[model samples]
Target: MNIREYRAFFLDTLSKAYDAAEAESLFYICLEELKGWKKVDLAMNSNAELDRVELVKWNEVLTQLEQERPIQYIFGNAHFYGLEFFVDENTLIPRPETEELVEWIINENKGKKDIKILDIGTGSGCIAITLAKNLPQAKVYAIDVSKDALAKARGNAVRNEADVTFIEKDILVADSLPESFDVIVSNPPYVRNLEKQEIKNNVLQYEPHLALFVDDNDPLLFYRKIAKLGDRSLTGNGKIYFEINQYLGPQTVTMLQEEGYKNVILKKDIYGNDRMVSCDV
Candidate 1:
């Protein structure tokens, strides 16, 4: 089938499961991947035909999409901060909000020299590596409890050519970091287990539970642990940054303040929900 006909069929098939816009975008992404053609090429060469092999591959991707599989997982790579990183079930797919958190850190510490940055629960090493890449003079270190996650993070460091030290250590453990850092940041597992029902099935079912859930009774477990660690591991005038649960923003800031982190600030996201918190040590 030609590109135009296949795109229409693909969209029609997926529209039953997803909205028109998402379905169209998914179809176009697959087309670009399989045919090595961009949207401009599609517009100019609508008559371009797909060979038998290409058609089979396209159909396979379509089948996966119909089953609600994420296109990023299907492609095995995702774009973040203008860089591509490999992704899989071992790590959570990096989100745009997390990118915003990175931006906040970069902008807040733009001209600082020899800044020591530590990223706790650095899945795919996106935050740590992005900071390292953007701030070349900074020392970046990342830690994750799961070795599988750390392995992927290490690979991402190499892939991005960012010098990030990946360590396999649980952040909840008190004696993890041997030395202090200038900035500590994390996008830890803050989703309370009870909130599973509120999340889309595509995420709750497909994403790694280890990287997503915290006990409802102690939803702040990771936050508290990281806060204590940050207090112990930060240099004088150092800062702590967290991507927090919107529902628990004030509580999170209060927790950090009680732990002796001063100047606790809660920053709202684009949706006007409390999303990020930063504290000075």
Candidate 2:
């Protein structure tokens, strides 16, 4: 079919699954992914017919999108912290809020050299690799419980050309984390069971739950564990960062203070949600 027809099909089919504006956006994204054509090219060559092979691939992606699968997963890649990383169902897609958290860590530790950084529960290695790329002088390590996720993370490290050490270990059950870390950051499981209904279907259906959830009775379980680990593992003036649940910001801050973390600060994301917290050991 022609480019205009394909674009219309994208918007029409995706509209059934997504909002109008979002469907429109995904159309452009998928168009680029399928044809390597910019929007300008599509607009200028509106009536140009797509070759059968290209049409087939575009149809496959459209079918997946109609099924409510995330576009990033369909494309097998995502952008975060100004870098691209491979993604699959094994890894939670790197998010914009997490980018903000990375930016915060980079800004907080700018000009530091030869420092050690550990990323707990590093699903896609986005946090660790971005830090290593930006702070070229720092040593970066990432850990994940899932072997599959670690494999993908390792591949992502290579794809991004950022040197990072990856480990497969469940932090929740680990004896101890990497020691003497100048910075420790985790965007661990924080979604409570009680909040499951609030999750979008695309996420609940496709994203891995191990990286997304915690028990409602103990919603801050990962945070508490990571903070305690940081208390024991962080170096002098070591800092701990977390992308926390908005509802539990105060309690997370309290937990950090109780764990003997000083200078505890909870910061909001662009959306004004209490999404990040940091403290020094």
For each candidate in the order shown, give its overall lDDT on alpha carbons: 0.88, 0.89
CA RMSD, predictions in order = 1.1, 1.0
lDDT per residue for candidate 1 within 218-260, as digits (tens), equals 9899988888777777999899999999899988988888898
* Number of clashing residue pairs, candidate 2: 0
* Per-residue lDDT value at 139 in model 1: 92
* Per-residue error (Å), model 2, residue 64: 0.8
Clashes of each: 0, 0
TM-score of decoy 2: 0.97
Q: Estimate each model's TM-score.
A: 0.97, 0.97
Candidate 2 lDDT for residue 103: 93
* Inter-residue clash pairs, candidate 1: none
Q: Which ten residues in a row have the lowest lDDT in candidate 2?
A: 171-180
